[model samples]
Target: MIIVIDALNRHRFKGLLDEMHRLRARVFCDRLGWDVMVRNGREVDEFDALDPAHVVCLDADGDVVGCMRLLQTTGPHMLADVFHGLLDGEPPLRSSRIWEATRFCVDTKKLNGGKTRNSISYVTSEVMIAAFEYAREAGVLDAVAVIDPVMNRVMCRSANAPYDYLGTPKPMGKVTAMAALMDCSEERIQAIRDFADIRHDVFLTEDEAEALFRSNREAPAQRTAPPAPFPESKTEKADQMPKLPRAPHSNALQQYCYEQVLNAKSQSDVDAAQALIEALSDALGTTSAAELARLARVEAQATRKSVLVAAK
Candidate 1:
């Protein structure tokens, strides 16, 4: 199996889009039964602008076996509109800290690498490697997916994915799943690429996938198998995550600024807010009690919202 991780050009993009629609029609509209919109055997949506989109391919003997779509979470992305209903509300997308991962599919017909490949392992490894490259190029700090609970475990175990539960796995026509975010990191991404090594056919045969599954199963017990690295602490993640800075604030705008501070993404924002609060408190040391209470109210409201969102 060969992995192609390129942004689809005009002709290539159209061809790929056609191929995607064909595959979707076969699996979704015809076999399992879904009501996806299609015209002349193609799936086209407003989102397919050829920008903020990526396509990954698994070519075996010139035949496409697997494919996935990636989208960035800029303004008007799925996370804020269509997919937002899948989760509690919109995740922190405005800070440009995370991207959305979606439209993942594998050709079951070509899975297990046909008869030539040793086992199902080859196909699985190819998929993993392609996914990591997609994540890196797309600047995806996190990936959100609505997938089967069983497959969710496979993602966590085989791909070293870190996730948080969003909702109960519900049936979407034939697919039963819930949404979750896979935390992206350099270490986990590298491990996937190393295991995939598509330059050689080593990871694409059936025997390899079986071995991978077996080894993964016994990985916790096997001293030689490296465990997934521990994730950074919440505070550390918050520090790394970017924050949307405040615009100029007037007396009326000061309340809004205080609210935004509570929703801060990094420690710097929190520290700044703390400093401002201290300065204001000191200045109010000789002021009337009424004025001090008004200032406290602004800070308190902002802090409450920020903490609540972070906890979720």
Candidate 2:
């Protein structure tokens, strides 16, 4: 199952997020030998603080097997800050319609690469489907990623090649990296789905994912795995990352709206939460508390009328 953890719902998946970082540490720091920050066997960095969405893949046992990070190109990202040279001095792509996909990794030690349910190839494609579908749902048109040559080839082999490259590939310390741009169109998604032979929806609703993860209270420690030829950031420096803006949603009211969405027991209540969530997401990543309360009042009144009509 695929669970998309974002800033709004991250509070509930702390353990899963921690496991994802440790998995990154194993893949990037241990296997690939990429320069990154590893504290307590967990690889984390400045980009993690920017409220980026995480597309996580889980097995039947609820163990996180594969994962990838998604960040809006409108803000700071790996390509814009760290891999700027790959753009040949040209301005990095920054638009709401575009997002950056990075930190792609899988559990090689646990996920045996093959045609099984726990296979690395299947899980990798699953993560890609979730990321692309999540991006497409959010109105994103393109996704740019900083990847190594090996991953570039992997993309091609999976029937998901990049449509274009921003600049020439430059040799990093151990591997050459390039900025690859891929479209989030239906054709691209379908090609990958066909390659993986997956026909069902890979995504799981928040409630379902939560139940799965919580099902195994005595489950073993997260089974960490290798990214299987993916790329991650090199030489993480927190000082270079710009402080995130405080505008938009990140306030008490937004939190309240999210709580309502999660706790809604009726369809009208669900509709109200959906309106608040969408409006907040639509207006510049988030909105102010005043605006949120106003929207809540309007939605609540509509919901009350619907509830009364249903009772009659």
Candidate 1 local lDDT, 1-312, one digit each (tens): 333333443343344445655765665566556566777776555656635444444332223455555566666665566655556553635536566666556566655543233234445555556565557665667766556766676666555555585645556556675767766676776665555443432222222222222332333333343332212233553354333233221122133223334355455555554444343332223332233344344545555677889899
Cα error, candidate 1, residue 76 (Å): 3.0
Q: Least accurate stretch of 10 residues (summed lDDT) in model 1?
A: 244-253
Q: In model 2, which regions exceed 4 Å deviation? A: 219-312
**Which number leads on lDDT?**
2
C-alpha displacement of 117 in model 2, angstroms? 2.1
- How does model 1 score by TM-score? 0.52
TM-score, cand. 2 vs. native: 0.71
Per-candidate Cα RMSD to the true structure, in Å, reads: 24.1, 16.5
Scored by TM-score, the top model is: 2
